[model samples]
Target: MPPPPRRRGSSRGKILDLIRTTGPISRVELAEMTGLTQATISTSVRELLRDGLVSETGRGESTGGKPRTSLEINPAARLGIGLHIGRDYTTYIVADLAGTVVGRLRVAGVGDSEPESAITRMAEDIEQLLDGLDVDRGAIVGVGIATPGPLDRDAGAIMGAPALGAWTGFPLAATLSEATGFTCTFDNDATAAAIGEFWLGATGGYNTYASVYMGAGIGVGIVIDGTIYHGKQANVGELGHITVDAMGPTCACGNVGCVELYAGPQAVIDAAHEAVEHGELDMEFTGRITADFDRIADLALNGDATASAIFARSAEYLAAGIVSMVNLIDVQLVVLAGSAFQTIGSLYARTIAQRLGERAFARAVQTVDVRMSVNGTDAAALGAATLVLQDRLSPRSLASITLA
Candidate 1:
């Protein structure tokens, strides 16, 4: 067998990332942006070109001499998979090297089911999706799984999470890899969404920012200098668990008056059900959290006072938590993502942005930009896939080996 290729340095990954984000770019431009020497950028980009990971799109305007050849990512050169496991639904996405989602699927979540059984079923779904797409298996980099967490990533295990307690200490990465015949990496959904946004250059070039993801729960993902900040135990962002009400009820995570207790999707759904029971809302709901949440949003949009009050209260609490986060981290950008925000994102966005504009400690010095994720409900799933792409194609360090 031929000897494995020598692994290149971090510079290669850095250059590739820049190309994907701001491509049809010249080698000179890369050198300028990265502050790497012209010689170094040439060497790294040459290796990327040789490996079929990058392509020279064409020439650009000449500065003084010969026209410069612009380079861009070869989107077809590689593929990645992202599996987002949420409270009520699971999503799968396939993205090419340029961070564009090529295929997607959604299915029932791990609600009241055995964690092991759920993983097995997801694995089969992945195989079938790939087969249906007729994707070149050899081009597949790997899979990244995003789940609600308070987990141990190095051990590839979930320590524990509410409603997902049965998955505690489960070897999620190993089990998924075993079932799918592909390498797997696991992380919390919020962090994955942040990475996905960063991978797609959605942060408007800010090196530090936070993604406030609302799904079954609320969580924050912090990225500083272009990397996810996995504070001790790889569980840094728990924005939902932050105490928003000192006199409120306790949460499953043992916190008092968490923002999620008042603002999460489940909270909204429960409140809607209570309103219906009390004859406040003259409507029937199917009890599915997402569907019910959407219905409430529609009613609110259509001028239902009760529904508007429910979401407004939720938005108020969520914005308060986010304002606190901004006060603490001072990030200039806060992105709203995940399934919960898919329908009522505008409400949350306006509230959060207003709170930040008015209350953030840095409000005088900087305006924190808050926007909805373009990926919508697919944000976490796409980010999960981006985890694989970033790891394999543009990792910050030398670790992964070239695929055979």
Candidate 2:
């Protein structure tokens, strides 16, 4: 919490950022990279070194000149904590300054506990994690919480959720802060995944894309030119509620035939179990929704008719949803990441690509790219960590620009 050396409007930010991306670089190389004079680069490097954010790696061979000192980011100088609260389990990760996940821990979820009790347990776990890792408390920049949403992020409260409404109207971030003694921030899981992708994963250089987060439910986080779009109260991208089948079942959101009713892994598992009960499905899958779906998807890939049809039905509905989404938003890229996508992701991706090719409004003029996240099931948690980084280094006041 100590005041960071003047960041905004300071050449040090730019210089430090460049060194991180293009390092073991020399002062001359940094100057060449930033178009800053050698003296300006020296001044910024001095500030960065004094702040302990940058360190000199051993000297490197020169290009027909004297050996030069190499510069690099001091990743271990600080840490960020990211937590993902979900129905299956909760994940907590600690990332260093350079976005490396240096440690992680998972524990039983809230179960039937109330929101206050659940958050209290999470706080304890975070304390244990830090203590076990022996991380300096001052080195922890802050904590970021990612959870299922319809959140009032600005107010740091949960609005609604799927089976998900245990904490509506609770001041989550503030309450957690009071308990843990660390500043806490919150974002819907889908949006957190997008920010994670923006900061530490694939979409770092890309300005616009959509990340579809499928866990117990489905949601999309939209980023345009490096800024996540948060409509009036941060309830913006509830993509699962889109009606893909007008004649399908009614949804809890008071909508008929919403895509999640068919494509959410829980929905598909329910459908699969129903098929099993009727003896239409040759195999039975039971366990966590994600595991059951993974088994079912494996059967489908192995050419079982029932399993294939089950995933196909889900994929068709998902395709309908994605096509509708791409048609409306026109983002050239859509990234699939979450616990659900860990299995059957390729099926969804292939089907979605095919759907976009055939049904997207501008298919003839443009192509939409569907990708799987490299961050995998950890995307939300990792992105949650990225939120702490973003808040500390790249404030919204510097919008529409690359984050630090």
Candidate 3:
């Protein structure tokens, strides 16, 4: 037996989110954790079960009474599409409600290409990916796009980001939605990665953390008390633009000695080229940042002193920026994510941890937990997909209030 369909409310979303994040929970536990009455929990659970968003797993231990049924999210109930538009490549992934990547695709980036054509091509790529999956397209609630930041979230547009040339002021969300026939939403890549981590239960019991994402540039995503910290204009984490050296080269963002200029993928590529010119490293430049950076990373891994030094220097600079971020945010956990960290994630994690232990302002009070993303390089894309699920299933709100 199921309850009749009632008007959707914020309570239902919160209940569903709890099941997704901390599932196999009994109705009594839900009521206890949410501070909602048994009747309210029952009503919400019934609605969730009727909507096929949750399922009764099995009977739980009896507490001197009838066995309680545990509830969990139905991963197959709905799906979401996530796209990470990078300067070198675009990653597309389809995720279930559990934040699991069921399918994925990678395609050429939108380098100097017309935004309209690039977006249309990306839509086609998404169609190609969906066609290969054995799932109903209607089950997909929407698409979430993660790209370089300075985004106008309300307008669903990408501002004039340096790495994303020719995509300035483009109504990406609306256009992609029209092209793909699904509602689309957009956010900063770093923010999306952080949200994805949170949605996937990567933070464990910790409610506050920061996601440090490195792609073509460096960025940070802050999650405070289980919610993303989207400052004014939804562009809060521009860690790359933060000045690390007062006299270093100026960045496209007009900040001198910005961390990104020294630690981002482009910085690695530029440093590798310099090493090649100096006849120090014997690797041919591919002119493509991804390809060239891969070579440098390989050389560094293979004990090339100059190559390793380039990466080490970059890590040091990035560490300084992260130290500043941790000091300001006062978060305990920091997650390293993005394509740029794929080959050398552990190195960055180790370096950042060491630096934070020595330099963080709160070192005396608490040590910052530095680790790599569970989603690996696909974090941003997977996070983008989770954004769709979060938007449709877990609308953000303050603490859940007790139901009358």
The best candidate by lDDT is 3
- Backbone clashes for every candidate come to 1, 0, 0
State the lDDT of candidate 1 residue by residue for 90-192, as single tens digits.
8999999878888888988888788789888999899878878867788888998998878898788877788678888888899999998888877788988
For model 3, what is the error of residue 292's alpha carbon versus the real structure, in angstroms, after optimal superposition?
A: 1.3
Using TM-score as the measure, the top candidate is 3
385 Cα displacement, candidate 1 (Å): 0.6
Question: Mind sharing the TM-score for model 1?
Answer: 0.92
Q: Which digits, one per residue and each the tens of the lDDT, describe model 3 over residues 152-186?
A: 88788888899786888888899999999998878
TM-scores, all candidates, are 0.92, 0.86, 0.94
Ranking of all candidate structures by their lDDT, best first: 3, 1, 2
Off by over 4 Å in 2: 1-17, 25-45, 58-70, 246-248, 282-287, 397-401
Model 2 worst lDDT run, 10 consecutive residues: 395-404
lDDT (CA) per prediction:
0.84, 0.80, 0.86
Higher-lDDT candidate of 1 and 3: 3
Over all chains combined, what TM-score does candidate 3 have? 0.94
